[model samples]
Target: MRRHQLAIVVKEKEYTRRIADYIRGSSFGDRWQVSAFTHPDACKQFVKQGYGIDLIAAETDLLRELQPELSHIPAIALVARLGEADGQFELLQFQALPLLLQGITDQFEGLCRKPVKGLAPNTNGKGALVLTVHSASGGVGKTTLALHLAGVASARGLRMLYLNLEKWNTSGLWLQPGGDAGWEGEGLSELLYAIKSGSSSHTSWLAQHRKFHPQLKCDYLYGFRNQEDRATLLPADAAGMVDSIVKSGCYDGVIVDMDDGMDELHYELLMRADRNLWIVSEERSALAKQSQMLHYGRQKYGETFGRIAACSEVVLSGINSELGNPLPAVEAALAPIALPLVREWRRGELHPVWSSSLYRAAVDRLCAYLLGESEESRIHAVG
Candidate 1:
């Protein structure tokens, strides 16, 4: 395995030693070949000595002094205080070692913006993981959680395309208009239309309409503006679009935001998905609806539903913050994961940052788990 070279330059000898020790002892040791330096001069000497470094994490002073030499290498500025980033990437000087590692990893991920070359050959035939997020009930914060997961992954440098196939398509409000699409991209609507009309290849259509959301750090397709366009989406068309996105190699994977309908379309999506996230609120009605939906799926599809159910996990979403434990009995009862209610979101405040929020913290853990799980699945496919 050709590990990426990472250089850590900090004035504090002890801090550099601790980080080096942690990286060597942790899974990061496999991905990163760490070279620690307590002085900028030594680091400069090493760089001049023809040491190839993929990334550098250094104190602001060292990074500034070495700016002439590191004009090309991706660098992370270690800062002691929080202030305006001023369009420069930075990480706090002190943090949990794991988070620090994750931060650095995210930067590396952003650098490649594609499946790491090392992991691609040892995985499934698919170009990327397929994640379908659906629910038996609506208004359970499914889209929000899905977007946040994508955002967290994007922030970490893992790429994904957010596809909202919901009928009403409320998630469109969050995505900014960019890429070739600009403000009037009509991505999902056009793609579905093209699919139904059999006009062009999926790859061409996808590339033509895909938009980049700057804030979320993920590529996304804006939903159909017209209700009729959404109504035209067929089960096969939807599944085919997702499959194309997965095989397109345009992203690390696809996050399909599904509606609350228990129909043929939903079943096709769930079955095709590599990972299924069934989002449900704590409301008894929502839980009942989910149970009834499953019952019907099993009664109707039998063995097929069984396979989908086996690969699926029920996640508790919109857990009330008023509660002491947040998870309550639901954690043990249904969900291996729970998404907390963001009171700020109720007031129409979009999350601008992920590093500090409790909500982001939970999402970071979930994203890490999903990526790790996907990695395991990829390796298993190799076996």
Candidate 2:
């Protein structure tokens, strides 16, 4: 990995110190050099002098002021607080992607953003890995798969994240009930508001809590809580947030849980994901939904959709047939219909107490697959 410096741009001395301290105090500072700027003007001067910066942690207004001179800099908003009134997601929508792309574009202007500095030629490999998990039909267990994949990767000691892109499922299942134990009103909704409003001390405000599972490694950013919040993360904004995380270099792999229903946001994510999983179930409805989704994907992406590199079918909650127990009278009723490669999961096989473990295994397989490994290839591996 190429060493990249973090340039902190803020006007106040105290604020600059706080930002510096935040970096020095975190895992990033231990390895990367972090510098502070008390004024936007000074930071721009540093950039003009060809003192390159790989990342910037700054305020939104402060960032805008430096945009012209620091146009080439990669940045992430250092949100100050966590509250619903802040419009955190909205802020992420506007700033994240443009800033990262700006940095990349600046670095590779001669090559048209190609060969991004410190990356392999012809390879957009910025050491950033993004994975998307989606099912055309609900109840096929995409969330379960996403959650478990994060756990397994984390267990293998890889820095990873699980992001749910649907408000209802994200809040109801992943963030609300499951993520609230250690955190206080902090979920995707709260995170979005925090960043947008530019409060203070927001690090802990965005992390999701979970029961321990050794195999999966990750953090999480849940989807919107309702139309109100979703409205904040418009298509452009979602793209920006994703770019921020990718440029942050804080994660090795980002697993996004896409909604089953087709939408502009979903389509946008499908374009960004390095690996896309099209999960389907044996149910006829699921098959119908998958067919429609596949049609849309192929139509929109052309041949690229076929060459997406990683695409698979995951059959979940299917029937269990014991050996020599006589097959079900109707084979069609008992088996998953013409499933592609499969990961069979049955509630009956898992103990209630091992729900977390079961979840971890599924996610582990997912991470392994994303990193270009087969399930039988390794007991444990980290990207």
Candidate 3:
């Protein structure tokens, strides 16, 4: 038996046709059986005839009229604009057709107890694992490691998305050949807007906006193109964006190259991530900054610190194998994963060189750890 049925009840024929067209062309159409009704009476009659309907989206007035009969099914009221409230169904003002359909689908899925077909069942019900690479000090090769980890994971057949949240990102220079040509659409700014406006089509929007990096063998969404756009992004907005991306179920792992400095959004992401890699350099200033960050996190977060600390790992970059005294406070908090500095890295090359070096082995170990695979298991399989 088909488990999902979507009924569209609206007064206007044009609106019904438009919505139906959008659904047919959307991801939802492949997974759902959709029906449209132009009259309230017709919809009620269809329901009265004992037809199975899992979800319904209707005009505000029609939704109110049919609420008593269709109270068992999940319903969403389509409003002309924002600010009007409806107690019956979640109020969604019609905006972009894709977003509208996505909003309705999200609400329907939440209300319907039965699982919908075609959507992958979240094994743990938390969706994808979000991994964040962050640092309080800059120039510690955070982006390099983040990209390498993502690339290695993708090569190992894990679906991954790399997101650079820095204010000024040179990801284009490294990931693409042309360097930001013909890729000038809204990108993260539009995504941020979609999240802020409570748009339901965040996943769809992301799918449409994401660009593939051939060399990295993974997909990525560009960060804010300009510095001016960075000011508008709030911490909650960033958190919401990440949540939507994870809930989309498009990737097995999402790697975030976070900006420097301890902002609310950065902390929120660290708290929410499945694993947080704090990259630091061996330089005195970088070590001092790392110590300060640790102290601040413990003092400010209190009990939440334990949860974040449990999932956190420190990686010390640009280090040579030498007996050097390190900060006791830093060393005690977390054992650092040592990533040796690569000579090719100084040439400012865009391509990744992971296949033929010790750095590659280090990155592979990191990847294995993130994927929860034991080194012994991997070795045994090889043997």
Best by TM-score: 3
Q: Which ten residues in a row have the lowest lDDT in candidate 1?
A: 374-383
> What are the models' TM-scores?
0.61, 0.53, 0.65
Tens-place lDDT per residue, model 3, 1-383, is 35388888887788778777877777767767778898878888997888888887777778888868778877776766432333344445557776666566555543543432212333347566688888889889888888788787777665678888777687766676665422365688878877777677665466446677887678788667555667667878877887877776566667888888786877888877877888887787888898788778878888887777787877777766665535344732453357876666767654443443678677777665544567554410000
Candidate 2 residue runs with Cα over 4 Å from true position: 1-123, 170-186, 190-217, 222-227, 300-369, 374-383
Order candidates by lDDT, high to low: 1, 3, 2
Clashing pairs in 1: none
- After TM-score superposition, the amount by which residue 122's alpha carbon in candidate 1 deviates from its true location, in angstroms, is 11
Q: For residues 171-240, could you state the per-residue lDDT of candidate 2 as single tens digits? A: 3333344444233434566556655665442422322222223323355653454457765577655655
Error of 2 at 215 (Å): 8.6
Q: Model 1 over residues 199-256: C-alpha lDDT tens digits? A: 4355434543567777777878766766786686788988877776675545676788
Q: Residue 89, candidate 2: how far off, in angstroms?
A: 20
Off by over 4 Å in 3: 1-124, 179-183, 322-336, 347-356, 376-383
